[model samples]
Target chain A: QQPVQSPQAVILREGEDAVINCSSSKALYSVHWYRQKHGEAPVFLMILLKGGEQKGHEKISASFNEKKQQSSLYLTASQLSYSGTYFCGTEYNNNDMRFGAGTRLTVKP
Target chain B: EAGVVQSPRYKIIEKKQPVAFWCNPISGHNTLYWYLQNLGQGPELLIRYENEEAVDDSQLPKDRFSAERLKGVDSTLKIQPAELGDSAVYLCASSPGGRWGNEQFFGPGTRLTVL
Candidate 1:
């Protein structure tokens, strides 16, 4: 099943922070985060395995809770280049990976 | 270290016409996937192939949509008698294997417009 993302859209100023959440109804084995710019394909960001772990990328970080089947992405000190649509994909049981609707984030100076 | 590559970035065709998109995955990647993304929606898997074998294609519309990865390196997705609803972005992704957790590289995607 497809994951559900919260806060359909968000606008932030440079150096601000934002959080996007994704939840699934099924037992999640892993969660993947990606960002897509308009007219471009989605870019892989980071992946969190089923161990309720957290990973960081530069200033971006994410936490996954296997028990709740939820994951949250955190963008710290957001930069203008961070403007794009963010999606969280969840993998359940087997190799099935489903993406969320997406959250559009606009970062301005 | 090139990423996945897709051709004919944009295409336009009338209903009932046929359209095909090609994709080349990253070298050494053994798993490939095709997904359809509609406007304002997330991508949905159309098919998945492990090397030259199609291990999962249940979501593919076998009636009008067909896909093949002949050499296990390059793939082609075809839509016959295309319908208006088929207008969307087709994305190709590749990963090392199913054991790899959510680490897939994507192609630029081919946008198709059906009139």
Candidate 2:
């Protein structure tokens, strides 16, 4: 099954902070995040593995709670370039990956 | 290294017509996936291939949808007698094998418009 993301849409100004959450109904071995801009392909952002392993860029950070089957992406001091749709992908034991509906974020100056 | 490559960035077809989209994965990548995305939504997996062998296709509508990855390099997805509901973007992604849960590289995707 696909994961669930909260806050269908978010509008923020430059230097603001926001959090996007993703929850899965089943056990997840890993959580992947990607961002897609208008008229473009989805770009890989980060991946959080079970046992508290996180791999991503310094500009962005995320956390995964295995017991809760949830993950959160944190964007601090948002910039206009951050405007796009964020998708959270959940991977099960079988290596099947499913993505959430997505969270649309618009950052303005 | 070059990223995933897809052809026919935009295609417009009438209902009941046939359409095909192609994709070439990055060098030496053995895992390929096809996804469908509608407006204002995230991508939905249609099929997954592990070195030319389709490992997962539960989400694919086999009756009209078919795909092939030859020699585990390039892939082609076809829709016979397309329906208006099939109008959407078709994305192809790939990842290096030998490890599970690796990050995937996606192509620009082909925008299909069925009229």
Candidate 3:
């Protein structure tokens, strides 16, 4: 099943901090994070395995909690280039990855 | 190495017409995936292939949709009779097989418009 993302959309100014969360009903074995700009493909950000460790990609970071079957993406000091739609793809049983509805992030000047 | 590549970046067809989208994943990448993204939604997996074998296709409609990945390199996704509701972006992604944290790289995607 698809995961659920909170704060469907968020608006932030450059240097602002924002957090996007992805939660699934099923147990999550792995969680993948990606970002897509308008009319573009979703680019790989990072992937978190069962263990609840934090991952960082430039100014963007993510944390995965296997116990709660949830993952959170943290955008620290957001930049204009950070404006896009963020999706968390949850993997179960080591198989196909299912994506969340996505959280649209807008970083204005 | 180049990233996953998709062709006919944009396709416009009338309802009931057949349309096909093609993808060429990064060389040496054994896992290929085809996904559909509706407006304001994340990419949804339609099919996945490991090398030349289709390992997962459970979510595929199977009625008017069919996909094939020949030679375990390039793949094709075809819609026999398209409907207006089929208008969306078709994405292709690939990963270097599967390990603990292999991240899938995506292509530019094909935008399908059914009138």
Candidate 4:
């Protein structure tokens, strides 16, 4: 089944912070995050593996909770370029990767 | 190294027509995936290929959609008698194998518009 994302949409001013959460009922082996701009393909941001691993890229960071089958992406000091839709894709033991509905983030100057 | 490449960035066709999109994955990546993305939505996997073999395609609409990754390097997705509902962006992604947390690189995608 596909994961669920919270805060369907969010608006932030420059330098603000935001968090997008993803949860799944099934056990997740990994959670992958991507950001997509208008009319473009989704770009890879980070992937969180099992055992509570945290990965960081620039001002974006994410954490995976194996027990809760959930993950959260944190965007710190948001920039206008950070405005995009964020998607979290979950993978189970069977290699079936499912993505959440996505969170639309608009960062205004 | 170049990222995934796709052709025909945008296409407009009438319903019932046939359309095709092409993709070239990054070198040495064994896993390739094709996904469909509607406006304001996340991508949904249509098929996944492990080299020249299609390991998973349960979500593919076989009645109207088909895909092939011959020689395990380049792939193509086709839709016959395309319906208006098929009007969406077709994205291709690839990743290296044998890793529990490998990242998949995505192409710019082909946007299809069926009228």
RMSD vs true structure, all candidates: 1.4, 1.0, 1.3, 1.3
Q: How many clashes does the backbone of model 1 have?
A: 0
Total clashes for model 2: 0
TM-score of chain B of each: 0.96, 0.96, 0.96, 0.97
Tens digits of lDDT, candidate 2, B1-115? 9999999999999999999999999988888999999999999999999998999999999999999998988999999989999999999999886544368889999999999
In terms of lDDT, which candidate is stronger, 2 or 4?
A: 2
Looking at model 3, the pairs that clash are none
Instruction: For residues A1-109, write the lDDT of model 3, one tens digit per residue.
Output: 9999998999999999999999999998889899999999998888888866544476667888778888889899989999999999988867579999999999999
Residue range A4-42, candidate 1, lDDT tens digits: 999899999999999999999999988999999999989
- lDDT by residue for model 1 (B18-55), tens: 99999999998988999999998889999998899998
lDDT, each prediction: 0.91, 0.93, 0.90, 0.91
Instruction: Give me the displacement of residue A26 in model 2, in angstroms.
Output: 0.3
Segments of candidate 4 deviating more than 4 angstroms: A54-56
User: A10-106, model 2: which lDDT tens digit per residue?
Assistant: 9999999999999999989999999999999999999899988777778999999999999999999999999999999999964578999999999
Across residues B1-115, which tens digit of lDDT does each residue of candidate 4 receive? 9999999899999999999999999998989999999987889999999999999999999999999999999999999989999999999999887664258889999999999
Q: For this target, which candidate reaches the highest TM-score against the unseen true structure?
A: 2
Interface RMSD of predicted model 2: 1.1
In the order shown, the candidates' DockQ scores are: 0.79, 0.78, 0.85, 0.76
- Per-residue lDDT, model 3, residue B30, is 88
Best-to-worst order by lDDT is 2, 1, 4, 3
lDDT, candidate 4, A5-73, per-residue tens: 999999999999999999999998889999998987788898888876645476678878888998999
